[model samples]
Target: MLELLGLSRVGEAVYRSMLANPRLDVGALAAETRLTERQVRTALDELADLALLSPVSGDGALRAVVSPEVGLAALLASAEEEAARKQRQIEQTRAAIAAIAAERSAGRSGNEIRRLDGVEAVRARMAELALTATRECMSMNAGAADRPDSRAASAPLNQQALERGVVIRAVCRESFRNDPETLAHAHWLVGLGGQMRTVPTLPMPMVIVDHRIAILPVNPHEAAEGAIEVDTPGVLAASCALFEHVWATGTPLGDAAAAGDDGCLPQERALLGIVADGHTDEHAARKLGVSLRTVRRMMSDLMERLSAQSRFQAGVNAAKRGWI
Candidate 1:
């Protein structure tokens, strides 16, 4: 009980002895405590001054007395008051610490801005921001570059956020053709209660949350060259608006393609299908079990045959040509 009151070992022993043996003479108390008479008397005087003890007899025998039950109750009450005071002090200290941290982060600018360069750096930043997200998160995927890495990093963070009751929304290229990996990732996000949509073409690869944080690729071609983190409200809001615009015209990736028995050139359809899934030269080559050079040559021939300027345009041209 004395320990709960924040008393030292000696103080606790003295107090407990007084409580156990009320109205004991100084010498008897000393004997019970295994302390010298002088030491016991000194402790008793201190306790009395603290209003924990009093004189119970009129005789001059130095028979120190413990206070009444009401006094003991008051002492307990004082301890409670002290505990409450300390708790309040602790809370104030924590608030100060949080304020300092916020100020430090808010003051960062220019060189203080973390410049993540390279694929590893970009992945790390995404993971960091995803983990720190509190209320909501938004994402837009342009070509699905680095998607595998992004999904891997987001999975655990998404799970944690769901457990913490955060909302997540993701927008991807509408052309996704239900590739095995992309489909699995879409299902995972949807199962976690995340909202998702597909757009014909994302304005950019970016992420924004709560109008306070944003991440966008530094170089569209070299996705591994990292990205810039934006904290400015105006910039983040603009990015969010762009995402919303695209999302409004987007379709759900899962509904992009349907089973068909109508006759069509299977190779042309398959090529278009893979392109829609965001496969680059190397990716399409591996998926088709063909050499990189062969895939490149075939892609050139397909583009020329369709009279298109780019791979994406070629895919559209193929559809327009009634080949897929």
Candidate 2:
């Protein structure tokens, strides 16, 4: 036990022996402790170094053993002070590391934007944001959120946020209902008290946590590249506004998206608007989170329903009927 105060076992034994038998010399201490005289003398030197042994006045060959209550207490107090100093140093080092990290991040894009270089990095940042979120987590995702792998990866983070009583509101494409697995995942989210809504198309994928930070794809057309984290108040406000505007026009996950009076589903009407804007079928498929084949099939059906011979005529006919 005394070793913790920097006393060796041999020194501790010699000190205890000297304390209990104050009249004993080094030779006698060695015999009592079953140690050699040299070892005993070494312990005496150790004790002297620790100020546990003091010379007796008028007796050059004799030394007095300090009481444990005094010597050990001083040693313990020194050890405690050393430990506290180390703790302070550790805290300072931690602060320095945080500052260095912030500086490195800011060097890339002012403090308002941080670039995540890969998919793994983006996921890691999102997970961190989810863990630290205090109030709400809102997201507008394209088709990726409906993929089995993406859903599996996000389940735990979503559950953790929900369990923390964070309000989670998500918007995805209405095309997710066509896939049974995606629809089941949507139901699971709703069952957990999270709000799930769908729109005909999403402009981009984004996540806003606590209304403070927003994560957006670096390239909306190529989401797998990476993402950027934004904390600028103006950007966050715009992101929140975009989410709210889309949310206001969304169909809740539990309900079916009703078609307009023109016999075109919202997605179908959205397809018409995209065609009218002169976007390719591939672009429309990407925006609607559907396959190119599906987009072509919808276009063909629309053309047949409108009795139009060509794509341009279909758009004209649909507009005439107020379908657009």
Candidate with maximal TM-score: 2
What lDDT tens digits, residue by residue, belong to model 1 across residues 134-174? 68888886654336766677788788767657788887654
Quality of model 1 by C-alpha lDDT: 0.68
Collision count of model 1? 1
Local distance difference test values of all predictions, in order? 0.68, 0.88
My TM-score estimates for the predictions, one after another, are 0.48, 0.65
Backbone clash pairs in model 2 (N, Cα, C under 3 Å; residues 3+ apart or in different chains), count: 0
Candidate 2 lDDT by residue in tens digits, 1-324: 777789999999999998999889877898999999999999999999999988887755758999989998999999999999998996687467557655665676534778899888998888777766769999998873465677788888788779869999999998878888888888888899899899999999999998988999999878789999988888998999999999999999889898877778989999999999999999998889888999999999999999999889999999999999
